[model samples]
Structures are given as C-alpha cells and as structure tokens.
Target: MNRKKSIAHKLLDAIGLFEIHKLIAKHINQHHADIVVDYDLSLLRSAHLIGAPKIGFFHFRPKRFRNGGTNKLRRIGERLKHYQKLVVLCDEMYEEACFVWPHLKDKLLVLPNPVDLDSLLKKSACSIDFPENLTPGEYFVSVARLTHQKNIHLLLRSFAKARELGCKWSLAIIGDGEDRVDLLDLSKKLGLEEAVYFLGYQTNPHPYLAKAGGFVMSSREEGFPVSLLEGMALGCPIISLACPTGPTDILQNGKLGKLISFTEDNPDELGLAMFEISNNAALRKNYAEESKLFSQNFSSQKIAHQLMSLLRDIASNQRP
Candidate 1:
C-alpha cells in the first residue's frame, strides 16, 4: 500500500482481495446484514455481490484525486459512484471531492474523527515517569510519527529558531518512525541536542499531552488528526501548521489555537508562533480554555450519535 507494485504483485493482490470479498459477502448474506460499510473503499466492486446498500469511509487525503494523473482520477471517480455515500474527515476535503467529481456531490459527507474525551482525561491522570530535566508546564510537546508527512524536521528547525529568539522551553517529541535517525541528525545539526528530547513512542501519550506547556503539530497533511483533538481535550495550548484538510477546521481558522504556515525553505513563522506561545501566559491560558471548550463538540457520544443516525437512514434505504 506504500508504493506502486509490479504487475504480478498487483494481480496477486487483486486475487486475494476478491477472495476476501467473497467470504465477506457470504458472511453478510448468512447474517442478513442490512448494510455494508467499507473503511478503505476497496469494496466498491463487491457491493453488488454483497447485495446490500454500501457506504465507504476514507480517513486520509486521497493523493489520487489531487496529484494523480487525469486517467487515474477518472477511474477513481468512476469507482466512487458505486457507494451510497462517501465520508471524508473535513469540509475542505468534501469541497475538494465535490470539485473533483461534481456528479457525486450529493453522495459526499463530512465527518470529523471522534475523540473519547472522558477516557483521554482519565488516562492523562495516570502516574508515569516523567523526564526530570523538563518541567511539566514549561516544555513544548508533540506526539506524531517522525515521518516526512509529520514533518518533524520543520519542528526541529523551528525549535532552533525559537531558542535563538530567547524562547526557553525545551521540546519533547513522542513518536517513532523510519525518519527517526534523520530527524535526530537534524536536531543535532541545529544544535538542539540538549534542548530537544526524542521520547519515542509512548503507549499512553496523554500524560505528556496533559502536562505540556503547549502542543505543536507540524504535519504536511492530516485527516482530522486525533492527536490534535486529544491535545485540546487535555487543555494544552495549541500551535499547528495550517496543513491540508484538517488543522484549519480543528483550529477554527486560529480561533481555538495558534495556526502558522511555513514554506519549504522558511520555518520562521512556526518559530515565531512557538516563541509567542512560550512567552505569553495570557495567550496560552486563553487558547487552552477555548480549545477545551471547542473539543467538547467532537466528543465520542456526539459524533457517534451522528454516525448512528446516518447508518440507520442508510439501512432503511433512505438517503442521508
């Protein structure tokens, strides 16, 4: 799923998917299922075989609809016509989808990811060994994979610039990925060896999120990031890049948090955001309160009710 496959590999994957679909279809028929929901949109061809109304959900920004060649996008649009409805994570994506396939505008739905606020709050209270050098409410924290998409390198560069600008807070990154070594190298190259701590992946990142001075997201793209919502639920002041698809919606165009944009060669805007958040206590408190209040709108119960209503309508052969 990461890259293009050889023709032989593609053929094998297609055969395997067909078998899986057949088994799934048989199970649905035996169980008298009223609807079929595909999270990956791979079941489009198998919808008729399953003999049930089908819904497709995709979480990430689909690269095909954006940058993929014209022929591939046409094929994707054709495949999408089989679904009773398609759910995307944010309004920006909904607009993009409608623009790409105006014919299926009525079939598109915007549904942000839900966060279990109560559970996250409870988890944030659990006792864990925190770093001794970093004070709870004085260090910036980020929880994301160290990947090109997450853009940890930009964070490191921004942290460096913030440090030069007299921002005293250290940064704690709480995830791991293939780009770990490169990110670490960049951190050292920027002379942040002592100021930036790579805590790697944590089974429970909520404690860190709950106690940090600020939560920062530097992703290049996102589909309604759950981590951002978790940070909000934990009442951390937020600083996120105006990335594709999600951050703008989550931050409410910078009302709920500090939103910054950056170019490939310049991360000064992000640096200034970090510096401002570090220096201004009133700003942090205001953003934290607003973020906590806004996060309640995305609670599990509320979003679940909306989803259940949609499923019930679809199940009853009604358009939603």
Candidate 2:
C-alpha cells in the first residue's frame, strides 16, 4: 500500500501543523523576554497561539478569489496593526496574480528565492544520453511546468519561426502537467512535433542543464525563476520574457540575456537573437560567466543568515 502510506504521510503532515504551532507557542512563552514568530497562518488558527509579537511569512500566496483575498487581507491588516513587527518574505516568485490584488504590496520584504549552491554545483554533469535521433547543439532547453502561465506556446512559436528561418534548433522541455498533451498538439500543429521533446519532470535537471547550450523561459510572469537561476548557476545562456518583477531584475534589464515582449513578441527578433547566439561561442561563454557570478546572490546560506539576523533584531526589539 504505497498509496496508503502516501495518504498517511499527508494526514500526518496536516496534523503536525497544530503540533508545530504549539511548539512555537511554547518557545515564545519560554523566551517571554522576546517576540512571537508565526510560520504559516493558513494552518494556524490564532496569532495569539504563536505567542510572538512579530511574525514572518515565508512563501505567502494571497488567495485567488476576491472574497478570500479580501478576507485574508483584512486579517493580515489586523495582525499587522497588533503585532509589534510584521515581515513577509514575498519571494514574489509568481506575483503576476498579485496584479489583481495590488493592495498586498507593502507587507512584503521581497526576499530572493534561495538555491543550495553546493548541491547545484555538484550537479554540473549530466547523465542523460543524447539519443541517436537528436543532434547535439541543435536543441534549446526550457525547464518548467507545462502550464499556461509558463507561456510554452510562445516558446513553441518562436522555435517554429527559428526553424523556418533555417535555424537548426530543437527544444527539450523538461517538466509535465495537464498542459503536456495540449502543448504536444500545439507543437504538431506548428509543424514542430519532431523538433520538440517533452521529457516530463526530472527531480535532478542539472544533468540536462550541463549538456544544454542555453536556457529559455516564456513565462508571462514570475517573482524570480529558480529555473533561470539554475541555468545561470550551470553556465547556460539565459533568455526569458521581460515579465513583471523577477526576470528583468535577474537579467538586470536585458544585461544578462535577451528579454522579449510577451504581449507582442516579435519572433523575428527572438529568432535572430538565437541565431546570433548560436554562432557566437565567445558571447555564450561571456553569458555563462555572468550567469554564474549573478547566481551567488541567491545562495540559501546567505538568506538564512540574513533571516536569523532579522529575527534576532525583532526579538531584541520585542524584549519587554
């Protein structure tokens, strides 16, 4: 009963939330001289239970429905007023949704999403074979869920155009979702069925990354793409839509890679850029170096230390 075990783990995780809340409450009580810390309130019932005058929200996603977001916002607003300190780690990784509820802006601390540098560096090699049918250096790699938000269609359209321009490039998309079938169909419709490969999800994509010549993203938006960071960390030349908050910041407003328009994208421009990058080995190497250097800012250890320092500062301020 693997399914039963999976179900059991889910049940345990759900139940453990209360235990974690209680433990945090206990710690707050024991350190009565300091502040309170609430992990995630979607599970915790009361702010008082966590016992901290200050709270840090990690990976907070505002609910979608109007009523839910409004209710959650009101609740958070109340807590913000009551709490001595309120900091939200709005890693804003997928903040396109936040465009709908712009009011949720001020509460965010905008921490960068962290990556384990050591682990990522360790995966600099790929084991997956370049199948006989595939041509080395003829494929572009994009690693993300096959979802509408990821704008897979734009990438497909761009690739199709690139192919029509006599550019020899295939696309290897790693990661799967409900959009897989539809995306496959879209590739076929665009006469790109043989040119694109959907490899589904891979727990370790570093191997694939190492063999890839470049990385691309057509997402409509993102806070900061971990995939982009990974590509940079692995020395793959990066390209992404000039989406909302993340990509531009990561690319330093096109300083790192080509940032194209999502609304009125010119495949001609994109294909030309790709064509140029394909031939320019020096430029590609330059981007690789830049990508690696840029990735250091998102290290997990650095974020953790910053978080600890912030917590200590809050705790000190809360000492009564």
Candidate 3:
C-alpha cells in the first residue's frame, strides 16, 4: 500500500543528506578543533565525523515520531550516546509531552527554536507584484504547508466566509503538502477558487511575504514556528490562532498580533480578524514595526553566536 511506500521513503529521507548541509559541516570542521552536531537541525547527518568531538544534538520535542520506529531518533540517540556532549533545545512548550521521554529529560535545554533572521531580513526587501485584479491591502495571507497540523482548511473556510460577508479580501496560501488536493476541492466547494490562490512550494518565501498585506497562522499546534518569525521580520501584520507553545508567546499574548481561541471555528471570527488587519492600516504599521524589533533575538547572528558559545563551552571541556 501507499502507507508502506511512505514509510520506506521516510526511512530514506531520514538518511539522505542535502548538499548544502554537507558543505557547511565540511567547512566548519576545518575551523573548529572538533565538531558537535545540533539535533533536529536537519534530517541529514552529513556533519563532520572525522576526529570530531563526541557529537551532541539539540532536539525538538512533542514526539515528531515514535521512539522505536523513528530511524531519525535512533540515529540521533546512537550519536548522543557516543558523543562527548549532547544538548537538546526543548522548546516543545507543551508540558504534557515533556516527560514522555524520561531518558531525554536530562538532556533537554528547553530553548526556543532559532531562525536564520539575517536571511529573513535580507529577503524582506524582496516583494512580489500583486496578481492582476488583486489590489494591495485587499489580501490576507497564510504561509504554511497544506496539512492537518497547520489547519489550512480552517483558514480557507474562514476566508470564504469573509468573502460571503462582502469583506472582499483575497486569501493567498503559500507552500505545498499532502493536503493540497483536499484544500483545492474545498475551495471549489466554497466557491473560493477565484478568491483563494494556492501558491505551491516556494523555496525562498520572502517575495510572497513582502507582498502580503497581513500574515495569518491557524495551526492546531506548533513548537516555535519560523513562519511567524519570518512574517514578523518582513513587517507583515499578523493574526495567529492562540495555540500552545509558539504563537501566543511570539505575539506576547496578543500584544504583537491578534490571538483568538482555537475553538472558535466560525468563519466570522477569522473574517473579523481579516477585516481588522485589512481595513486598519495603522494597526498593520504598528504591528510591522513592533514585530521587526521582536524578531531580532532570533536572527541568524544571534543564533550563530549562541551556537558558537555552546561550542566554545563544549570545546573547552572536551577531553582528548
């Protein structure tokens, strides 16, 4: 069945290495006396293995996969046991999931995920031209892989309802995933094919971010989403579902952007938010300014400095 193939592919992907990671690790190894890995950083384990210090990892929690069947976890644990130092970034803000893996509890650092803020900042300058018939400030945007976890369908329904209510704003979705076909069908069913534009996978999402009038996230759950950070950096006003562990914190409990209950499934709730951001230019401008300042902490330089500091600490204590 398809599920079997999916499992097989997951195994292979868990083992595959992207060329960029290889090049970076190879380059870093040349400088550092010994290299230690940060976990959940990538699916690829292409980092330096030659005379490297005991490899350490910074793991994400909330159980991306089961402990035994997950080859990625297995591989990471194998490395951790053999490596001199293993550090985990335990930003799996959902406390319920925290103690599930008792063995990993001691290693978890409880750190927030880091974003390549420099890249986002540089990309923020780029912009996309609005589609013909689409006017600036007349669109709401949600950039997320079309998937259940992201609740893209909820966004689509809300936007459709907003249209029905004569809000007249377009919703643009950027990113691709398994839920694409279902979402497209839902759009057609809701008569939103014209109003909802599905922009397939974008490797560099900055242009899309730049043109967007406002940003929205309707995730059911998340562990420090980078899209929110990228949106903040790009100065797009935001409206995110008040979800656990990520959005509320990033929004500073609705200070930076509107945070609503995940239980409110009515399109009107979502539509009202869309209307507020779309109609209120001042609020958008204020949000954009505040977001840019808030996003600085997660910038690449800051994260890289933190990583290097950890490296120094490990390198200093590492035994030959």
Candidate 4:
C-alpha cells in the first residue's frame, strides 16, 4: 500500500486507492499464485487483503522514510513485518528500512537495480536524427521524468551558469512530466534557449545516450537512478547530485562519476561540476573506463538470481 507523510496525501490515497489491484490479487490467489511482488507500494494492502504473500519491491526512496520525518512512514515500516520480504535498491536504503523497523530487518534485501545493456546496444544501432543544431559526442544528456522530485529546474540553471563559464556542450533532456512547462520557462528565463534542447519523451533514447559526451543528473532525491546506470552502460561519463540511496553508491563516491552535494535552489555546485566534467578529458577518460566496470554489477543475471532465491524462500515458508 502507498504511504505518504501528510494527511492530505492520505486523503488522496483514500480517494483513489486500488480497485484494479484488488481484482488482480483475487485472480492470482484463486490461481494458486503464492506471492505478489509489490512493485508499486499502492497495492500492498490489496495483496494482503487477498491473503497473498508479498515482496515489497521498492523503486523509489520513500519520501517520508528517506528524509526522517513524520509518523506515517513509521507505520508503513512497522507493517513490513507482515510482508514476505522487502527488496531495496541499495545498501543505504536497506539500512534505512532496517532502522525504520528494526524487527523486520531480517526481511530486508539489497538488490541493485538492473538494466538491459543488450537492449540499449540494440536500440543504439537504430537510426534517429539528432535535434537541429546538435552534434554527437558534444553535449550533456539527462533522462528523467520532468517532475518536481527530479528538480529539472536545478539542471537548467546549472547549465546556464556552465555556459557562462565557457562549457561548450549543449544539453538534451529526455522524458516528459508535469514539470515540463515550468522547466522550459526556467530554461528561457536563464537565457538558455539555444544551449538546451528539450527532446520530450523518446521510446528509445539509446542513440542519445551513446553519443552523449557526458551526462548530468540533478535530482532532489532518488532510490536507484536508472538513467545514471544506463549512461554508464553506454560508457558516457556522468555527473549527479549526491541524492540519497543511489548516486554515491553507484559512483563509488566520485571514483567513477562526479557527485555534488544538493544545495537548495543554488546551482553553483552542480554548475561548477558540469564545467569541470566538460573540461577534463583525462578525468572523463578514467571515469568512462571505471564506469564500464561499475555497470557490470547491476547485471540482470545477478539481480534475477537474488529475486529468484527470495521467491523460493517465500514459497517454501508458506503455511499450507
């Protein structure tokens, strides 16, 4: 089930809770399915109401839990004792979950998010025209939903400053979301109309990923950061905000990619980082080499093994 910090969120959850999941859980249970992997926490309550054992697959850092606020998260964390297991995307999240509900610590599993490297390679081979006035291997790319949590506003401002500081690369953002209008407005406000190219949503952005000279992520927070991992898989050097539960772990604290501290509304740190990453060819070379190795750890085979093992354990422990 979804958990939110504010009563307003709780009200919203109550209004639009799960009629679909409830029906699907019934079908799965009737068919003798032993477990439901809860990708979206919105369905956890329905899974249990149907008497199906669930493995909570955490895809985002729970805002209330990650930032250490409110009683709502504690209630949700305490409810973890009822789940078959909790699969977190990184060690920091695993620890955070344990801290949230110490008694359910044994039920927590650390599984790095996996990417389809082969699919990326396949898509990269496809022909796609670059945006007008764009050059391959001469710009920064970011792939994320244009939402408040992603903080695309921070990215535009940093890019503007980086431009002022003589960084020659342009920016291409992939994906669309609620913040698109606001972010585009900010881009123009910062006088970045020519330097930034908003590509909207692309079904296969691998061509952009492959040709990118570097990548940058300025999210306010994240759980796993799939975009950053995809960049590494394609051998594009990266710079990211040191958002909890992902970037620091993936970048090995700046050994493979640059991680800047998140300063509220101030793009100075990330702007400086962008300029440095653009100018340093040797560092970029080393980062590219190191990131290639780093990307291997999130292989589908490896993560699938862990997930399968959890499934077996849950199936075996069921009280028939």
Candidate 5:
C-alpha cells in the first residue's frame, strides 16, 4: 500500500539522519571543539554524543511555537535537552518558547539579527539607473520576495486604498519570486499599475533604501527581518505590520516608526498610515532620525561582541 511505502521512506530518512549525526559527533570529538553551534533543529541530536557544549541557533518561527499547539511541542522540548543554549532572533520568540516549554527557561537567549551599518552606509551612496517617475523622499519602498508569506498582495491593496484616500506617494517593490505573475495580475486588478512599480531583484538594494521616503513591511510573519534594519540604517522612516518576533523589538514598540497590528483586516489601517507618512514631512524626519539612532544598537560589531562573550562564558563552563 502507499501508506506502507511512505512509512518505509520515513524510516530510511531517520536512519540516514542518525548516521549523519554520528559522523558529526565523531568530527567534533576528533577536532576537540570547544563548542558546537548549529542552525538546524535536526542537528541538535548530534550534541548528545559530542563532548563540547552545544548551542542551537533558530532562524525562523516554528509553527508549534506560534500556534501553541501541543502536537510537536513535546518533541521540540526533548530536543532542547541536548543543547546548553538556544539563541532565538527576538525577545517575543524567547517569551513564547519559555511559555511553551517553561522548563527550558535557563537555556533560552534573545539575540536579534545584526547588520554591518558601516558597510551598508557606504553601499547606499552608490548610484543606480533610478526610475523616471520615482523621486527620492517622495515614495515608499519595500524589499522582499513576491510571496504569500510576505503579504505583498496586502501591500498593493493598501497602496490602492491610500490612493483613494488622496495620498500621492508611489510604492516601489524590489524583489522577485514565484508569486510574481500572480502579484502582477493583482496589481493590475487593483488599478495600481501607475502608482505601484515592481523593480524585481536588485543586487544592491541599499541605494534604493537610502533614497526611499519610507520603508514598509507587510509580512504575516518574520524572523528578525534584516531588510527592516537595513532600512533603518539608511535612515528611512518605517511602517511595518507588528508581525511575530521581529518588528516590535526592532521598532521598540512603535517608538521608532509606525507599527500596525496584523489582526486588523481592514486595508484602511495600513492605507491611513501610508497616507499620513506621505503627507507629513516633520513626522518623517523625526522617525528617520530616531530610526538611524536606534539602528546603531544592532551593528555587527556590538552583536559580535555579545555573541563572543556568550560563547566564551559557555566554553569556560560558566553560565551566561
């Protein structure tokens, strides 16, 4: 039966993964590693056999943790025992993880994603074949793959609504993905052909970020978005949906920029925000200044130092 074949395939995968973990453990032992840092959940199993302390760096929001469903939480809890530390991208994720697995409290740590502010500033100064209609400090910009998760459709809908509300600023999206065709169709359907420009994937988006009047994020979910940070580094005012795990922490609870609730289904919320930012120069300038100043805290040097300090303490057998 098909069910039997599926089970057999899963069994093979489990065996293969176990062998890989054993090999990894052997390599760690041979190298006399001080600590092992893994990015995938599957690799945590290798920590059981490895003598060195292990740290798990999780990048995305786990469905189990998000929904608080008991289905796979127990399995995830079991995996946590193998690692001395677990690094999550945001404080919200840390709180959720501890809530779901209270016993793993001591193991959890919050480390937001870092950006090279110095290098990013340099790149932002580079010139590009700027769009004819798009003027600096007069348009909103977003950098994300054209996908359902990104909720670019929501962005287009909101842009249309903003136009109806008499907002004159245009929107320029810089990214490409599988959802491109569908999104383009939706853009046309929404009558945003003239106002909304799809620039596709750019090798260097920093220049666009620097020139943007505002940066917006409409994702349904994110794991400490680096694009938002890059926008802040470029001194762009921000407007982001208060999605899971990232925007709230980065925006410092809306002090740095506009943070909208994702639960509000009406397009008017985002539309009104876009309209307000576009019309108010003083507000934009204040938000831009705050954004740039707050962004320094997330520079690569500071984050690197914090990470090294944690690793050093853990390796030296001291709790951090």
Candidate 6:
C-alpha cells in the first residue's frame, strides 16, 4: 500500500510538472520572453512545449547502464534534444551526459552550484533550541534528507559499530524526510538511541556544522551534494562516500577530506573512518584547513558570475 502510494505520488508529481510548466509557458508567452532557463530536468519537455529557447540545468546522474541512465535519457529524448545548452553542475556529470547523448555533446557545459558562504556561516552562529546534550567540537554532524538515497541508515549503523569499538562520538543528522521513523527504530535497535540525535529539517543548519567536530555523508548517490560543501564552508572536517558528480571535485579527491566508495563499504570500514575523524585532532585540523581553501571555488561571487555569463552568452546569440 505504501509502495502504491509512492507510485501514485510520483504520477501526481509528473502531472504537476506539466501543469506548472504550462503555466510558466503561459507566463513566458504573456511576457514576450526570449529564453527559458530550466532548472528542473523533469520540466524540459514543458520548456520545449512552451516554444521558447531552453537552457536546462542538469543535476541528476542515474547509474549508467542500458537499463538505467540510458532508459531515463530515452524517456526525455524529445525534450532533451531541444535544449539550447544543458548546464551540468560538474565536469564529471557533463561528461556522462555527453557520452549518453552524443547529439547533445556541444550543448553540455559545466557550471557548479554556488554557495552563499557569508550567509551560511552566519546561520551557523544562529541561536536555536538545540539538543542540550550537544557540545561544540564533541560530536560529528551530517545534513541530509532522511532517505535511502542519502543513506542515513548506513551512517547510523556504522556509528553503532564505531561505538562498540570504543569510540564515544555522538552523531547529529539534520534533515527530515520519509526515512526518519525507520532510522530512529534502527538507532534504538542498535542501542544508539542515546548516542545518535536526529534534529530533523533545519532552516539554518550551518551553526551546527560550524560547531560540530566533523561532518559525515554516507549517501548512495548524489548530483552534487551541496550540504557537503556547506560543511566545508563551516570548517567541519568531513568523511563522505565518493558518490557521483560532487565529492571528488569539492573534496579534491580526498586531499581536503575523506572519500570512499560506500556501496562496497562495510559498517566497520565506515565506522572506522568516523572513529578516525573523531579521534584525531591533527588530522581534523588539516582537513578543516584544506576544506576552507576548497570551499572558495563554490563561493557565490564565483559561480554566480559563471552562471550569469552563460545566460548572457545564450541571450546574446538570440539577439538580432
């Protein structure tokens, strides 16, 4: 029944896409718009149907196999081909798209997501009704939707293992989603009800990241984990799964922080990584220093200009 509801929800979401895009198209027609900068991939078809020149920002990367990403590409092939240029968040994802749809090779461009460092860091200092037990520099933190894709289950279970191995680190995950109950149950099952804290969705999660001893991301997949970069900006040392399209570029292939392939990773391995990050002061300091350096690339002043320039160029071509 839950699965049926999930399918229905997705179907409704797809329908909503058409409805919303039609409205957007209607607005464009009303306003005499020149081009549509499409941010959501699901809306590409609508953007095309709207009869405006379309520039899509592609951020998702499904696993690349005949039955996987290829099939997804085929479903949207009509709208996909019509994009004036497909803006991807990173070079790696851009490369993957080019390989799948060679026809859109020239249309692909890499423009990573920008972060508001100053604003986020300020939020990191925000006074919130925090869990009283939480102490600055004593607990590891993560910010992700409580979902299978984000893999908080893996992080919880791994933290449990690390606990048994004599590490006394507490974990705080900030984000609310479908998997929260299941994760809480798992924490209880692992006897981590006390050690692990779920703060649910937070509007300003930076202060938690800023005060945290370190940050851990155990995601199974990602387009580009913006939360990972946010952690870096807040000076939180990190340990993350080397998922698609984000970590390598931001973490600089582990020069800035810990990155490993998590699908093949075991509880003990992840636990060990967590324990190491929590236990070592020197190592944490080094990663934090390197993280500060790496975060500058994603600063708002930087990527905002890149995106703006891309829009300017796209608009210029249509001029005259």
TM-score (all chains, Cα) for each model: 0.92, 0.76, 0.73, 0.86, 0.94, 0.86
Worst 10 residues of 2 by lDDT: 58-67
Candidates sorted on TM-score, descending: 5, 1, 6, 4, 2, 3
- Residues 248-320 of candidate 2 have per-residue lDDT tens digits of 7788777887766654346666666666666677888888898889889889998888778877877677567
TM-score of 5: 0.94
**Off by more than 4 A, model 5:** 1-5, 62-69, 318-320
lDDT of 4 by residue, 181-289 (tens): 9988888888888989999999999889888888989888788888888889888999998887688888888888888886648988899889988898898888888
- Which lDDT tens digits does candidate 3 get at residues 116-192? 76666677666655478666566787888888888888898777766666777788888999999999999999998
Better of 3 and 5 by lDDT: 5
Provide C-alpha RMSD values for all models, in order.
2.6, 6.2, 6.0, 4.1, 2.5, 4.0
Residue 90, model 3: lDDT of: 33
Residue pairs whose backbone atoms clash in candidate 5? none
**CA lDDT of each prediction against the hidden true structure:** 0.86, 0.68, 0.70, 0.82, 0.86, 0.81
Per-residue lDDT over 1-320 for candidate 5, one digit per residue giving the tens place of the 0 to 100 score: 33367888778888988999899889879987778778666576677798778888878774445344585777778877889999998888888778777888899998877899889999999889999999889999999998888988888888888889899999999999999998899999998898888999999999999999999899988887989989988889999999886899899999999999874356779988999999999999999898889889899999999999989888888334
lDDT of 6 at 37: 75
Error of 6 at 151 (Å): 1.7
Clashing pairs in 2: 36-52, 36-53, 92-223, 93-223, 126-207, 175-200
Name the TM-score of candidate 4.
0.86
Instruction: Put the candidates in lDDT order, highest first.
Output: 5, 1, 4, 6, 3, 2
Model 4 stretches with alpha carbons more than 4 Å out: 1-28, 47-52, 63-69, 317-320
The per-residue C-alpha lDDT of model 6 at residue 183 equals: 88
Q: Indicate whether candidate 3 or candidate 4 has the larger lDDT.
A: 4
The list of candidate 3 runs beyond 4 A from truth reads 1-35, 41-60, 66-97, 102-104, 110-113, 127-129, 164-166, 263-268
User: Compared to the true structure, candidate 6 yields what TM-score?
Assistant: 0.86
Clashing pairs in 3: 39-58, 54-83, 54-84
Q: Give the TM-score of candidate 2.
A: 0.76
Q: Which segments of candidate 2 are over 4 A away from where they belong? A: 1-45, 58-76, 79-108, 133-138, 264-272
